[model samples]
Target: MTRKIFKQFFLALVALLSVTFALTTLATADTSNLAAENVDITFGTTVDADLPAGSLLKLNQPAGAIYPLHNSTGKLLSRGIAGDASTAPSLTTDQIKLDVQSGNVYYQVLPDCWLQSDSTVTLLDSTGQAPTDPVALTLKFVDANGKEIQDAKTFDAQFSTTTDATTLATLETELLAIRPAVTGYNLVSADQAEHVITYHYAKPTISTGSTTVATQPSDPVTTTTPIPAKTEPVAVKGTAIYATKKIGLYTSPNFSKATRKIWYQKKQRQNRPQFVVIGYAKSRSGQLRYKIRDINHHSLTNNRRGYITANATYVTSLYYHQNPKKIQVISGHGLNAYQAVTLHGRKLHHYRKGATLEVKAVKTHGLTTRLVLSNGHYITANKTMVIKR
Candidate 1:
């Protein structure tokens, strides 16, 4: 009877000890799922370290269901669907799809969506510093489809020391990086459970294409050419009084028939008085005397040397005659013969219907009273016109 009693007591003690050990093991184990009901998604400036083992933190998204994140410089980091929790938060995947769809797994980091390692983001206090505890971290959530949800779709969750800070920081950084690119989504809420924090991101607006890209420039320089100058006019002078029917030079004292000629010669760099009747010529071989034409300086056909009388007329007037009293038709019409006289400073070269006198004064008479054909003409003192020589 003593042995039996001892065995029964020992057995009961063993059972009790086993039960106690089992209870302690159960209590000490990570019961993250146990406080799921008590876990309230709240926004605080800092996270508390003394939450229950199984406690869960939740986040309430903004009504618009979109969350935007920006750097201190206001540059866009990333954008995608937010608050829909079911999709992986990735630059390549759509975050909004996971929220509405079943069997979707959440991803902490997406390729190409995270900030460059050298960049830093600070979770500030209301004063913009890292708060010690119960600090609210604004998390920008994106779905698998990369659409931005409304602000009401955001999440806010409290974190404690019992919660993993490394994991929380990583999540926070990702959310911050992505928020700036969130076009149609808003932040709903965030929940924390032990070492894991879940973000509920929602979409308020839908978008199709990606953001705009920029362009760059090239290298090397360029150049161009310049222009040239213009040509000047030449001067001409002479004493020969050659005339066409329109332009005539006659004797000074007597106004009578003298000589009728065509061709006239001119020299270069000579300053003759303006409107002084000099020579006569024609525009063509058979044409009658017209007027004194233009005087050209150089001649290309004459081996580029200067030449006169190259252009002449059929009928030209000659005023300088050896015997002025005798009438002579050197070229054309005798009735058209006349004389040029200088009275005072003014010159009267055209004669009246009937005037006869002697050639008492002959001024600078060079060429004989001969008729020569030319290609140009000139103007008379009477204001009669001539063609070009």
Candidate 2:
């Protein structure tokens, strides 16, 4: 019996030792999986990585390829590699660009992909020199009528005769950044040219005039006809007119009352109240009134038909009535070309500032005129937007 007990105890001891050995092997395997392998990386020696762990970098990539650029904190930043347009780096290229830094900065090509001393990264100086032909830039502040309100400010140091797109765009951005504030005058337009920038401001206008209504009268009211006082016509049919002072728009030729009115507001740079003469209506006192249709877009009284004063002092012809032999876009912002005379549909094209376009024809649409272009597009005939060249 003692011999049997001894054998059982010996078997139990062997089983425990076997279990402990298996547990020790599993613990050693877990430790090996958790540790990171040491890698020797050299960035400048070669373009391609030789190690099995290092990422494979391609050589002779085109310029402007999107790369996985990283910041100091390993944050990814997308940037294009530098090169010429014809030979620029393609989008799929694995090339990267590094800006010269002051201290030790890390440039990560990809996740866990790095070049320490094995790859050669070339850096180029990108700073451009200033142009030698610098010119004086004049900023003219004018009122709504193109009359100067303040002395012209000249910045001789801020401008150069650089024709590059980046230089011109930077110059314009700097010009607007330093604009002086003028109290009691709201800026209307900033017309920019090669050397001159004209800023139009509208002064606060306080005038004494008859109050006008917004909506038109449903029915025309008859009034007693007075004896004739004046007989000569102020303007004939199809004449374009603009208000010099506040004016009322009457439903009829007679001065019964103004169903609607136009205020003397020229705050907008290109937009002003203008109309085309349809016919004439003689008031009771025989005062000639211009029967008109509103053509100023975005105006509350746009497209309305009424009779207005024909006094040359109050209403006058637009700058030009006929199509110019040649026209150029003068507005700082480019003008839109339309498919039709009326600006009702989507714009057909946009002509940038300083573009010269040939005029094909001019037609009267809603009293205002539209210039048909040589390219079969329509643009506004307003003098403020385009200049006769």
Instruction: Write down the lDDT of every candidate, Cα atoms only.
Output: 0.26, 0.49
Candidate 1 lDDT over residue span 285-311, tens digit each:
322221122322343211111112212
User: Model 2 misses residue 284 by how many Å?
Assistant: 4.0
- The local distance difference test score of model 2 is 0.49
Q: Could you give candidate 2's per-residue lDDT for residues 35-80 as a string of tens digits?
A: 1111111111111111111112232333332223444333445432
Q: lDDT score of model 1?
A: 0.26
In candidate 1, clashing pairs total 126
Worst 10 residues of 2 by lDDT: 34-43
Name the regions of candidate 1 deviating beyond 4 angstroms.
Answer: 1-236, 240-318, 326-342, 345-351, 365-389
**Model 2 Cα displacement at 187 (Å)?**
49
Q: What is the TM-score of each predicted model, taking all chains together?
A: 0.14, 0.30
Query: What's the lDDT for residue 191 in model 1?
Result: 46
